[model samples]
Target chain A: MNKKIGKHTVRLESKPRIISVTSVVGPKEGEGNLKDYFDIILRDDLNGKESFEKAESDMMYTAVLESIKKARLTEEQIDFLLAGDLLNQLTSSSFAARGMNIPFLGLYGACSTMTESLGVAAMIMDGGFANYVVAATSSHFAAAERQFRYPLEFGNQRPPTAQWTVTGAGAMVLGKEGNYPYITHVTIGKVKDYGINDPNNMGAAMAPAAVSTIYQHFNDTKRTPNYYDLIVTGDLGKYGKEITEKLLKEYGYNIRENYIDCGEEIFDCETQGTNAGGSGCGCSAVVYTGYIYKNMLSGKFKRVLLISTGALLSTTSSLQGESIPGIAHAVSIEYGKIGEKK
Target chain B: MNKKIGKHTVRLESKPRIISVTSVVGPKEGEGNLKDYFDIILRDDLNGKESFEKAESDMMYTAVLESIKKARLTEEQIDFLLAGDLLNQLTSSSFAARGMNIPFLGLYGACSTMTESLGVAAMIMDGGFANYVVAATSSHFAAAERQFRYPLEFGNQRPPTAQWTVTGAGAMVLGKEGNYPYITHVTIGKVKDYGINDPNNMGAAMAPAAVSTIYQHFNDTKRTPNYYDLIVTGDLGKYGKEITEKLLKEYGYNIRENYIDCGEEIFDCETQGTNAGGSGCGCSAVVYTGYIYKNMLSGKFKRVLLISTGALLSTTSSLQGESIPGIAHAVSIEYGKIGEKK
Candidate 1:
């Protein structure tokens, strides 16, 4: 009856299935490498809304509704909506939930929200609390910039280590019964601070926590790098990816062959002038829901270890000279495997 | 097997028990009506810390440690720590979690986070996901004031409707095996917006949400307002409480006699000079954990419904001329009844 597997990992007895997924991106992201993977691409960031904040909420709404529709279920069927975003007070997700009319639980794992919500959703489903749950997250470049950095109109100079915040939203429907990829395990993370205080270089700041969770996941599940066809990290950009790889090697695990950072994979940093790469709640969200989920459905990858890393630092905290505390949650998904019925 | 009852309520089959509770507050809250109920009261807001933010984190850390110690459980025995605060990025909770080293999930529902975390903790415990879970939330007046309004040194004039943010933290330990008040039901709320744009009048902004969740809880459980010994709202203050009562009366259910708002109960507005009342994540948290939990344990009250209301608005959102969205989550706790053995 014990679902917990070792220190921080959980092995669900009834693995929850991902029934449907949807991704929406702004024009800049749409023009990126995974353009074909996105469901809807807005021509502009505002999407005809008066403000970027409203546009972000609309993107989340569209993603949630589209995901539900794809799952062949009505809004009434969803037992809970678990969501969060980078905006203060989770404005985007909360506003989007107002129109959905579902029971809601607002979470804040920063950019790791996608995996955090997915882990909680699977736990609730496996625990027999709900038959269906929707997990979603969103981010807007302008919205995040004004809150976390400078205002959009500030035109502040970006450092080479600074990463671009992706303007997008992603939603996934998890249910008790489905023929989709099954969420087998979840490793909740501990808040780890390495004293990296640079807000612009979030990749370096979050890398340590990503390595911590990755090592814990492998230790708890007793699975080596080969156990997963793809080991993906959420938004650790090029700089953080290198740090993670180096740290993992020191921990006696080499994930060099299979590991890839979602931020680095989302855009061609050289040609796009994105500095380090992409970073935000939507960075890994769109990548996972769009590219990874589709690939799993096509049987291109059988097993995946998806770890979304988040740098938990606010503009106020950074200004106060506090170091960034990072967290990374790992969710193991396997394709072509059906979990036992409740 | 379906734990969900009606539209938004879930009836916990196992009925997770609250093992222990702890509350730590600032001098202002310690001088309030429920002064004697708090476990620890600081002499000042900063608690010897250089910054109010660090002081809030310290309070949270103390509360979490005290709650775990009171439960007679080691840190390793605790499966998860679910927590949040009013600070941007949940810095207080995240910093507190770092010291505890427990698997952490940072939640944000504005001031409603106490009930939000508690509900999720109970569900996880009842669903057999974990034997022990800790739910905690904190808020600091100085921290919230500078972030949401004027800086502490600004000496700005306050509005009559503005409620003082409580500087405190409260934590509760929930376990599968405990002879304490059992969580019977939880009603998750939907975000409701009625175009109330003023952040100072949060009570007016959040009242409808409190009404919505309370109504749904009564409807789902098929119970009247008088079914319980008491019904308390999180931080609706005087204005929101009146609005909620009027709204409930229009729905053909009157809760005037049995209802009390934690904000209203915490500080006497006339004597304490808290314009509307005390309002923050810690308002309901300390009140519930310190006074209500103790009373329930002594059998002073058999059944109670605690609804925590929150105005989910950020400084940026308000500056952008957006209306505040409100949310409220209700948790029904009952004593003198033993649940099934683990």
Candidate 2:
């Protein structure tokens, strides 16, 4: 296969800008300490049977509501809702939107939903289909655990390479051509299956997918890592980040100096013991919306490339003995002033 | 509410287009019989467990592929996939797109996915975000019955007011300002929960919501029902259509004289024992894509307003004894001569 960058003559662009971010991440319910391996929040005033589900729903609701509220758009003013989460029926995103009562567009790309959604949203904004659109995603540690792992009461040991699912929600409001950080470009990933097996070892499963798209992004624009103040990959834990670094070196491209993986930066690896690092759609979301976005808005960083990566394998597929195929999408947000009005 | 028709404000538009339809329905599989209640081609090679689900997945896959084939656009030539379905979690839509490798936008509006999708797709096309955009939706009888009603083997008797879930799929492609019928207008509905209880009586529950939007659409555009060749509403069976007619008459508007409800037109009430009519996302989908579009392309109908209606309630909500809130969105499409090139 040809490995040339920008070899494809097709391109898609977006004109609108993302103005702000608002996030929500609360401590796990019933767990006395906030020092748990995951910094996830629960919605329950107290723990009970449906606490986990409620938490997932509430966290997503709070995150998006806060983002919209902060953007100064009332619920009725929003033109559309773009959201997704890691739930069987997408219960969390749908239930939250149901309460919100805003016309919605539900999406599913696992962890990659944020950029996938943002890409479409930015295009819509640029095309003048909408003025203000909101994109959001959520993940809950307990809910995901019960669904994919063991029951809450089950005392089980996770693999050393297992990554902790982030308990958080992240949201951003993309508005009409504005002065805020305008989204410069978007690049979607192709599924790349490398025969990785352990569900817990998501970093290894998704890292290659991340590297391929990031490399493609750089190649497409003929830009180097230094062009961006920060090059962030969503939820690639310790091992995955190490592998990504090695891959970049092999390609004679070095982003290691400013490269940041949402997983590794979100939690204290040693204290929190998130062996690989924080994972799930929420990891990159909370980190970007909570940490990176605040800094970007404050001028700490002028330009950032957010690559949300995901392993598209489901539990049943994994159980049926299939290797996980991964994907990632890159979205560039630049803090520089937007171009003059049309 | 003050009702005003903006008749002079309505500017008639036209865009010439071509689309292909593929329908899959019923018991015999791989090669079987056309369903009595629906027009999908069937095959006996596929078993019971495989028919509906596979039909759904296959029909949706073929719908897009065929539509794209007819449109003279390759998969890569399409910029985005705007799709939806009547399934738990929208699994059918997502799963089908997974193999196609196109950037996708998934949606759920119960029986109205196709129309809602058209509204969104047209917006994207009109906004220039995409040169070629596709919107498709599906529903499987066995699959829906298992999820929304009793299992197939349960042998539960359905009420006369009950509607059959059509096992079919529909798809369409839109281009930038083409010779085809230009999508002229879109009116999104505000969900109305007027405290209707019976889940089985969906027609009665959804009628008011449908009527409200239809009325609003005419008022917003300042056009009367007589302005279009056809005024179509999705999945409003006999009961719902009657209710809609009554409500419209109360407002001094008579739509029954020229209106056709998808549910009633697709399935025979006496034979199928579907008192009101056929329902499900697939019902309106096959009816519009197969029957309506074919007629429009042949010049039988020039202007049409597809007001696809939906009941936004879920089993959980119904279980919790909450009243079903319904909503509807209308999109106007017109067919005229293809312009000569400059």
Candidate 3:
């Protein structure tokens, strides 16, 4: 039985294992801090595709296949593919699913899709819906720029608080039986809006949501900041990470000692000219699949809480002067001894 | 346990019950064929909101609240809210979730969102992840028009194959315990594309997917068309309905006698000048909640197969000359005796 924790949290009786993970990144991200951890790095953002959109779909496709291959599982062994991207209609995920031929559930949580997919995949596996499932997400700078902001050709000047959308894709193969780093708990989030309307300052806009979810996760699980080796947030970037920490403090939790943001960790904002940091569905995606998962396997991080945050706003909504609504989902993964039972 | 039967189908042992459902539509849909079945009908599309987008959000808000009220459950009793819309960033669902303060998982399946959400919500309930979950989706004429096609100000001449987007919102509350109309099976879909690129003819684009899912559902469950009193396709409209029948015939399963489309049933295309028919997330949403669900309660239909189809194409992809990929999900609902067990 899946145990229901305090509120908004589910503690699985049979934890789902992260059997295999893979990350693919463009040249910019390849040159970032976690370059060595990425599986494949493209020479350019387009990755030889004619369009950025195609490149994004192709990247997700490659990541899914690569993750399955790394898991030593054939395509037929994977029962479902849950994926999403930062595109209208989730074109990247749908187009990618066209080739894979797996049953697909297209999700849209903007940047938080990584954790959202993971949580759903975990639940599906824990509930015995499937033996194995793949969760993947991707985002591209050019594709996101044209869709959410000015087109690449426009050469519009970005504000200081603006974070560059990462050109990357990440995929994880989750299964009922595997080694360490099992997903133990999941906390789905409620949307929170604090009247922030600036599209460029997404980190600040999404900070409150990250804070809200993290607080809830702690409250639901009766755990504190010291419970995990690290508490990582997805794509809150530098400013948003600071805001989240401040808000968490206000909520009577001090996580600053063992906390980091994937957005800030992915790029050296000062040297990379990425202003605040990287912010996209792929930001936390690649970082987790590449750096975090590998470290967990090596026993460098015994336990971790991964929370991916998203700002739910469209170009039309932003243009119409609506405040950005943010959401975040948290998943707790712990290192277990091989063949150990919970 | 969730039993995997044929290729893409799952037989849920713990069938989730549809406790309550509500539909809200604009004046156009209110004046259509299923007008009497709707819970609330707005006199105007804007619903006194300043913009069509806000109106869309507000419509979803009202439908969700009305459904919860009809379910006789407080907001705190609902475990999760699974929602989606035809908007770019799922603005309506996310905005509504912000106000509802429920844990939300935003999905994007275009028109198929109605069944997609219900299927996931049922799985969540059956999986013991939650006791009660709400599934909701909305679409608006002006909102979808400006986002997908020409703005309302453009006044572009409509093509004969073009279907009018429905201006409506529908919400259903699914719980572990209820009286009747239990969801017994769910079929997740694979993305299928036959090189169709015309976004205006969405029904034609989505017909193949609907046929594929319905065929698989029959094969997996080992039941023919006679198993259900009604086999309904979400919003294939007139042209797509014909295509679906032809495709089903090719598959050697004749469903023409028992088949009806929510799109075609909701509107008199000839008199309403809705071209082929209605096609939007809300087309199937309002039709299911207002017409089919109400009729089922009255025992007009004892068993039904509801398959909602979606043409997965974004404005960016369509502009870039990518073919529209389509998907469909099927759910089996039966009129169970009160307190009956499987």
Winning candidate number (DockQ): 1
lDDT by residue (B225-303, candidate 3, tens digit) is 9889999988888889999999999999999889999889888888899988888889889998999998999989889
Cα TM-score per model: 0.97, 0.83, 0.98
- Ranking of models by lDDT: 1, 3, 2
Which has the better DockQ: candidate 1, or candidate 3? 1
lDDT by residue for model 2 (A1-342), tens: 111125211233444667767666656311322223222344552233345666676778877888888788888777777777876546567667767756666666677777767766775565555667888888877777777778768967888788888877888898865567778677766656678978888888888878888887888878889989999999888888898889977887899888998888877777676677788877778777777776777889888999898776655456546566676888887776554321
Candidate 3 chain A least-lDDT 10 residues: A333-342
Each prediction's interface RMSD?
1.0, 7.4, 1.1
* Residue-wise C-alpha lDDT for candidate 1, range B1-342, written one tens digit per residue: 578888888888888889999999999899999998999999999999988999999999999999999999999899899999998889999888878779899999999999999999988887677888999999999999988998889998778888999999999999876578989999999889999998989999999999999999999999999988899999988888899999999998899999999999888789888988999999999999988999988888888999999999988788778899999999999898564331
Which residue segments of model 3 deviate by more than 4 Å?
A338-342, B338-342
lDDT of 2 by residue, B70-131 (tens): 77878877766777776654656755665675656666667767777777677656544456
Q: Which wins on DockQ, candidate 2 or candidate 3?
A: 3
What is the Cα-based lDDT of residue A252 in candidate 3?
Answer: 99
